[model samples]
Every structure is written in C-alpha cells, then in structure tokens.
Target chain A: DAGITQSPRHKVTETGTPVTLRCHQTENHRYMYWYRQDPGHGLRLIHYSYGVKDTDKGEVSDGYSVSRSKTEDFLLTLESATSSQTSVYFCAIMGGAGLAGGNAYEQYFGPGTRLTVT
Target chain B: TQLLEQSPQFLSIQEGENLTVYCNSSSVFSSLQWYRQEPGEGPVLLVTVVTGGEVKKLKRLTFQFGDARKDSSLHITAAQPGDTGLYLCAGAPPGSARQLTFGSGTQLTVLP
Candidate 1:
C-alpha cells in the first residue's frame, strides 16, 4: 500500500442517523477525493479537497459534506444517512493537480468502505 | 455534462477467448485512463492514454485511444479467470481539474 486507508471497512446504521467516514493518507498528496460506487451508476464523485481547509463539491454532494483539516486526513460526513447513501465509498489521492501531460497524475484509491443504511 | 459511456455493460467469455471493452463520449478529453476493480475494492489504474491515436500494451492487454480523444478501447487477448472484474474508463477534460469523469463500467467474467 502506497499509504491510503479508510476507516471502518464496513458499517451498518439506521436511516436518519449521522455518520462520518474518514480517509487518511501518508503519501502527503495534495489532492484527495471521495466517491460512491453504485450499480449502474458506477462511481460518482461526492467531494474532493485540494489542500487543508480547501474543499469543493462534486457531482453528487447534495446530502454530503467534507472537511479537510490536515493534509493527510479528509473526512466525509452524512448529516442524515439514507438508504440511497448505502454504497461503497472510496478515497483517492494524487500527487499533483492532474494537469494534461502530467502522466503521473493518476489517482491511487484506498480499499473501499461499504456502508449499509437500514 | 461531460459524461463517459461504456458499452456492453456485461460480458462473459471462456478462457483463451479475446474481447474488447469500449469507452466513448461526445466531449473530447485531455487524457483517459482505464481501471479494473474487484468486489469490495477500489479501482486500480491499468493504463493511462494521453495522446490521441496512441496505443499501449500491458502484457496481453491492449489499449487504444481514439484519434479524436473522445473514445478509448481495451482489448484483452487470451482472457483468463484472473481477468474477471469490473473495468472502468475515466477521462479528464482539458482545462478542468484532474477530477475524472468515469464511465458506468463493464463487468467481465472469464470462465475457466
């Protein structure tokens, strides 16, 4: 492992409960992202952080929020977990801004965290 | 929206067979990448195609980027059970952040 880990590899919770997932990396990468993988929809970005205290929304950020307090840790919080949020969540990191011609900008993903909302 | 579309959502073939997976989009990309994901795991990068019309091979796997940079294909020769997984294609548009727009993906099963 190049140094990316997600907490609570698996989880089960009731709907309407608040939940948080954590992503940690030791590579000191500048970019970190959170994505959800669902059947037929593949992986959809939920949020991403470029640096500590800097974050932005992704295509699917309606019910989700992210916080990056340090360069090595990014947290994704679901204020109210729902059945629809029951999907595998992945954390990824890249060394650079991923500009074109930056062949090494490929992201390295962590082992996914499976969440079940009942 | 710039979306990547992958075809043949599912494929099943016998060992030693040859097959191809495709990723297409109307929007041109600055670069494209292919990944393979197994159950309960995150996708692992297989290859990245940057130049239009470029081709790269990794062992028995062949990757091709369309001349227009709007599509790409992955061809596997002599498929094996080890190749069973979900194949995904992702693209990074020019001038945009390195956020990848991924295709739905292709689930491939190779029977031994």
Candidate 2:
C-alpha cells in the first residue's frame, strides 16, 4: 500500500542478454529494496537504496547493479541474463520506523516481476 | 548475518481448521514482521511486532513476539481458502531496523 510499481511485469530473454528492471514508488519513501524470490532460497536482497544517489549491495549482489537518481525510482540491472537469474523480483519501500509509533518499519511491496532466462 | 527459520515448510489443512507457523532465530531482533504472498504477487505485511512479548490480533489471526525477541509465531483460526499463500517472517537485528533478513517461508494451502 505504499504505492509501489515494477515495470515489465514479465519478461523472457536469452542468456548473455542484458536486462533492466525498474521499480517506482509513489510514496517517496526514503528506503527502497530489490529482492529475488526463489524456491528454497526464499527472498534474497539484491540491492537497496537509502536515499537518492545512495545505493548499497546486498548478500546476492553479484552480476547486478542498481541506481537511484530520483526519489521515486530505483533501477536494477542484470549485466547479462543467466539461467540462475530467473526468478521473481520484488521491490519494496520503507517509510521509516515508528511512523505509526512501532519500533519496526513496515515495507510496502510491488506486484513483482517474473523474469525468465533461457 | 541475522537468520530467521520458519517451520512447517508446507502445510495443508481443511477450511475452518486452525494452524500455527513458527519463526525462530537465535539472534535477538529489534523488530519482526510477518507477510503473506499470493501467487504472482509480492508479499503484503500482515503485522509487525517490535516490543518483546507483544501480541497482536488481526481478526482471526494472532501474532506473538517472543519475550526474548528471538522468535515469533502466527496462528490462524478457522482458516479459509483466502488464507492460502506463502507466509514469510522478516527480522531486523538489534540496532538495524531496515536491513532485513527473511525466513525461507511456509507455504500454506487451506483446502475447501
């Protein structure tokens, strides 16, 4: 409900091809995250942004890059699509903790994008 | 790295039955959140527990944070088909509130 949207809801591409996924948020939240969900692995963070022009790598950041030039948009890029990269990618936005007075900060998510690499 | 383990990787139960899913971690968490995700959709936050030993109820769903803040549980009463989805638990280690580590998740199937 944080008004998050991911572009190209589904995509199919061949190996060695480049791909980019976009995550746009309408809430202007300060923190944005990119995660890939796979069976057994659950969801692993790919990248995250703390603010505009501020981005950091996550546990499974290999072969991925991200940029956040605007407050409402964060982009995740796969330098070369691989079979290992096939998974559902989710974008989430955090509005900060205690906005509602709780110690935990809730993250709003987008519908997600399913990518297939052949 | 903070790791959360969700038990009962898969559960199948008839509608109106009760069920509970557990999320456990040896590391103390500053806060924990539960999320439900349906097919082809991202996870939606069901509830968040921050204080140790806090319990919150949402309709027929009950969520409890362990007194040590190292574990949590989610229970559903009279489950319905609408409750069929993947339940994931995410936790933030003490001091860090946004960088989350998510559990493997429990896939619940509530049969009609």
The candidate that wins on lDDT is: 2
Q: TM-score of chain A for candidate 1? A: 0.93
TM-score of chain A of each: 0.93, 0.95
Error of 2 at B14 (Å): 0.7
Residue-wise lDDT of candidate 1 within B36-76, one digit each (tens)? 99987899988888989999999999999999999999999
Model 2, B1-77: lDDT tens per residue? Answer: 88899999999999999999999999999889999999989999898898899999999999999999999999999
Q: Model 1 over residues A13-114: C-alpha lDDT tens digits?
A: 999999999999998888999999999998899999999999999999999999999999999999999999999999999756334356436888999899
RMSD of each: 1.6, 1.1
List interface RMSDs for the candidates, in order. 2.4, 1.4
For candidate 1, the iRMS in Å is: 2.4
- Candidate 2 residue A54 C-alpha distance from true site, Å: 0.5
User: lDDT per residue, candidate 2, A1-118, as tens digits?
Assistant: 6788999999999999999999999887999999999997778999999999999999899999999999999999999999999999999998776543556788889999999999
The weakest ten consecutive residues by lDDT in model 1 chain A span A95-104
- Assign candidate 1 its CAPRI class: medium
In order, what fnat does every candidate score? Answer: 0.61, 0.76
